[model samples]
Target: MLSRMKGSKILITGASSGIGKAVAFELARRGVKLTLASRRLDSLRDVVEEIQSAFPEAPQPLIARCDVTRRKDVKRMVEECVRRFGGIDVLINNAGTGVYGNAEFTAIEDFRAVMEVNFFGAVRCMMEALPFLKQAEKGLVINITSVAAKHGVPYLGAYGASKAALAVFSQSFRSELKESGVSLMIVYPSYTQTDFFRNEKKVGGARRPRGPYASPQKVARAIVRAAESGKRNLVLSLEGKALTFSQGVFPRLVERAMDRIAYKLREKQEVFNE
Candidate 1:
């Protein structure tokens, strides 16, 4: 599978850190041509330096500073990737933002903001890259979603909605692009040990769950392997697969469990502000 990706032109959003960063390193090791992007230029430079040092023979990646929320940034990033790499064979939509709180008090605008990044951001990249992807022999789009998308958690209602939207969008769009030779892969990863929680917009009233997080490297390897193997849907962690199963077999039981968790997590607190 790794040999299959060698020298393939691939673009990854949110490549500055976390799963994106880890994926960048893994793919570089696999000898893929890359265009690594994020909103932060400095961090991306650091990634390049590290990748160059570790894998001197690997094809050097093109770094683009992109904020997925902006149409201009996404469009320009794709254009530059095509200009530099000739064409894009793989598009990895890993950029996302989340707000933490109950849906009632998280503010509708916050939900929209999350949607802009988590949902529309991926959409923008897909729409921009679809043509190039179709031109490739077997173009692939990998959407990094979450297991939370399967269940609406208490404090993460907004985040869940955004991922759910992306998952559903990917499902429908996958079929649309099938005949075009463009395949879409949806990855539902469980809680990962990343800066995501530290950077999340905390709406208070609830605390994050502590425990059993998957490392970014582990998730990254899984994603790359899934793409190489041409897997359509990849769900990480035993918890994620179980959640998917229980939802189908015992819906009300699962809802009751969530209700209990929300009750225990609920408390009075002020929302964090900028």
Candidate 2:
């Protein structure tokens, strides 16, 4: 798998930080040529420099400042990647944003904004990269969704909805690409320890749920492994898998548990603020 990964041309969105940055480094170490895209050029450059420094022998990664919400930006990013790498063997749609609040408290605009980034962003990237992906020997598209999508967690309703939409789209598109030889992989990770919470657009006074969080590096490794093995889907962490399974087996029970946890966290946040 490592041998196959070496020299593969890959493109990653949200490459400025968190899981995307970790994945960039992981792939660079394996000698994959990369095109890293994000909204912040400065941070993206920092990531590129770090990768180049660590893997001096690896191909110098291409960087593009792309806001996935914009169709033009998405198109240009894909074009730049294709121009530099010849073709993209793997497209990782990892760019996403979140909004935190209860359903009644979160504004509709906040929901839209989250969907624009989390769901539509991945959609745009997938559509733009489909052509290049089709031309590859073993094309792969990996969408970084969340376990929240599978079980609509309280206080994260809007974010969960956006990811759920993306997850469903990934499933349907995977079937559509069945004959095209372009594989689509959906990744579900739970409570990853990243700046995701800090960067979230907070609509109401909801707090992040407390839990044993997975590292960005661990999630990135799972993503790369799934891509290399042509795995169709991956739900990272044992707790994530359990949550997904429990949701299926006992929906109401899981929902109630999530609500209680959210209540406790929100109370804790209120106390901290006080």
Candidate 3:
């Protein structure tokens, strides 16, 4: 159901900053009622203020402190969204954390933590929001997965695995909900200009991926477009598309290329330290 976003009620996680914050602003400009959730209430307030300043005509967004890793918090967040805005027309599962360093060096606990937030976190939100979504005339669930999910990368092995798991689940869930009024959309955004790198949990010092970073605003716009167009999947960059395609066709070759790139990144980090 390709409809305008003007009055849709949407709930977005990880809205404190980065892509989530950008998405909030973009949707606000479109006149959507929003519920922004994150663990950081102060940051969420700042985002709300920014949106009010920019899109004064838009409805004031509701904010809640939600740690997606916790089921109670997720439930409360969903309850609050429905309480404030009637029912959720769209749910954007964007809250995620990353872990850096080779899997060998990463602790099991750290890896599990990554999965809890990146994979299970989305699962919790989806499960909790399904009822409200199904009640809406045209409901959409957008899972913000990464390009790393396509092929496990070097330093981000845990992060990649977590996102890959979420991607697979989204695919299956889409089929299960096909008869229902809810639609599922998966977004694959490559390295984007955001504070995600700075906030990443690291087992060792790893350099962030360099260059060709898409702006958060650009990615947010693409997401809004996908929601309106009812696209099942949206890969936001040419590089991301190429990487995904090459990995599918020549898996071993792409693996070797990624290894070389990882080596260079590690070597650069070493040089900087020296």
| Lowest lDDT 10-residue stretch of candidate 2 | 265-274
Which of 2 and 3 is ahead in TM-score? 3
Q: Which residue pairs collide, candidate 1?
A: none
Per-residue lDDT value at 4 in model 3: 66
lDDT of 2 by residue, 28-128 (tens): 98889899999999999999889988999999999998999999999999999999989999999999888876667667888899999999999999999
Question: What ordering of candidates by TM-score runs from best to worst?
Answer: 1, 3, 2
- RMSD each, Å: 2.2, 2.2, 2.0
Q: Compared with the true structure, what per-residue lDDT tens digits does model 1 show for residues 1-274?
A: 3356579999999999999999999999988999999999999999999999999999989999999989999999999999999999999999988788767777788889999999999999999999999988778899999998998877788999999999999999998886898889999999899999888887744457685999999999899888878789999999899889999999998999888877766533323222
**Candidate 3 on 1-274: residue-level lDDT in tens?**
3346578999999999999999999899888899999999999999999999998999999999999999999999999999988999999999988988766777899999999999999999999999999999988999999998988877778999999999999999999999998999999998889999889876766556566788999999898888788899988799889998899899999989987977797777731221
Candidate 3, poorest ten consecutive residues by summed lDDT: 265-274
Q: Which portions of model 3 show Cα errors greater than 4 Å?
A: 1-5, 269-274
State each model's CA lDDT, in order. 0.89, 0.87, 0.90
Instruction: Show model 1 residue runs off by greater than 4 Å.
Output: 267-274
Q: What is the lDDT of residue 66 in candidate 1?
A: 96
